[model samples]
Target: MTKVDFYLLTSHQPQIRERFACKLTEKAYRLGHRVHIQVEDQSQAQKMDDLLWTFRQGSFVPHALMDTEGAAETPVLIGYEGEPGAGMELLINLCREVPQFFSHFPRVAEIIDQDENNRHAGRQRYRDYRDQGCSLETHQLSI
Candidate 1:
């Protein structure tokens, strides 16, 4: 069984989301877990990359622009492209659509409830995934 975590955040700021995702990824990495992130936009993806570089100066996190070509085999797969399949353990999803890529992973963490529709959708997703026997943990952020 895989551990899944969900967070309801009050802040709509891009920095807050980026920071939270990075922090979570760092924690996961420290615990010997692989981290996978998918940002909504190119700008957000760049911000995440920048944050990663800043956190570990000169260190590189594997990044590939999502498109029809698909993502190469790697630990951290960013962008909206590529098929979500085996080998993915931990996932940090920022996209509103909730890509089908994360379906196989039992452990999926995300920040939801940024808006009205999202609030409802997020809650529904939580319930649906939980009903499927996925271990779910939700945290509300002060942001």
Candidate 2:
């Protein structure tokens, strides 16, 4: 069974979610995990790719867009559609709906900021995971 972690952020700002995603991705990469970040669409995927490069000063997270060449070789990938690729151990979902391929990964991270819709969707996803018999955890992130 996969393990699901919900990151509850105090702010409703969308950028905060992206920043947290970057931080999580960086941490996972440093720990030698291959990460797949599922965004809502191509635009968000591109935004995530860009944010990962500059989210924090003097920090770097090697990543690529899913469609780009050499992406399979990178430790992190950003995508809105299709498979997460072989051997990707961690998934960070930035979409409102639960990803169909989420269970394929050993660990899934769902970032939920303080937006009303986000909270609703996160609750639904939490229930869905529980019903699926997956282990679940939640972390409240301040700031």
Candidate 3:
């Protein structure tokens, strides 16, 4: 069964969730887990790709956009549209709804910041995952 983790952030800052996503991806990469970050569109994917490189000073997380070249060779992928490639162990979903290919991964991370829209969508995603029989967990985060 796939495991779903919801990280509820106390801070409502718009960028906090994206920053946290970068941190999570970096940790997963260091731990040898291939990660696929699911976004809503090409713009979002580009945003994540740029943020991952500049999220933290001196921090480096090797990644590539799924539609771009070198993505197959990269452990971390930023995906907007289309199917998530094979061999990815974790899915960090930035999309409002769960991606159709979510079940293919062993683990999924849903980041929810304190924004009303995000919280509402996150709740829906939580319920959707639970109803699907995924192993669900929620964590209240201070950030």
lDDT of 2 at 116: 85
| Local distance difference test values of all predictions, in order | 0.69, 0.92, 0.94
Per-model TM-score, in order, reads 0.70, 0.96, 0.98
- Report the C-alpha lDDT of model 2 over 20-92, residue by residue, as the tens digit: 9999999999999999999999999889988998999988899999989999899999999898778999999
Taking the tens digit of each residue's C-alpha lDDT, what string does model 3 give over 1-143?
99999999998677999999999999999999999999999899889989999999999899999978878989999988899778999999999999999999999999999889999999999999999999999999998
Off by over 4 Å in 3: none
Q: Which stretches of candidate 1 lie over 4 Å from their true place?
A: 10-14, 55-74, 113-118
Candidate 1 local lDDT, 14-114, one digit each (tens): 55666777777767766766667877777877777778766555555554444425455555656655655567678888776555656667678877747
- C-alpha RMSD for every candidate: 3.7, 0.9, 0.7
Task: Please give the lDDT score at residue 31 for candidate 1.
Answer: 71
Superpose all Cα atoms of candidate 1 onto the true structure and report the RMSD in Å to 1 decimal.
3.7
Span of ten consecutive residues with least summed lDDT in model 2: 8-17
Better of 1 and 3 by lDDT: 3
lDDT of 2: 0.92
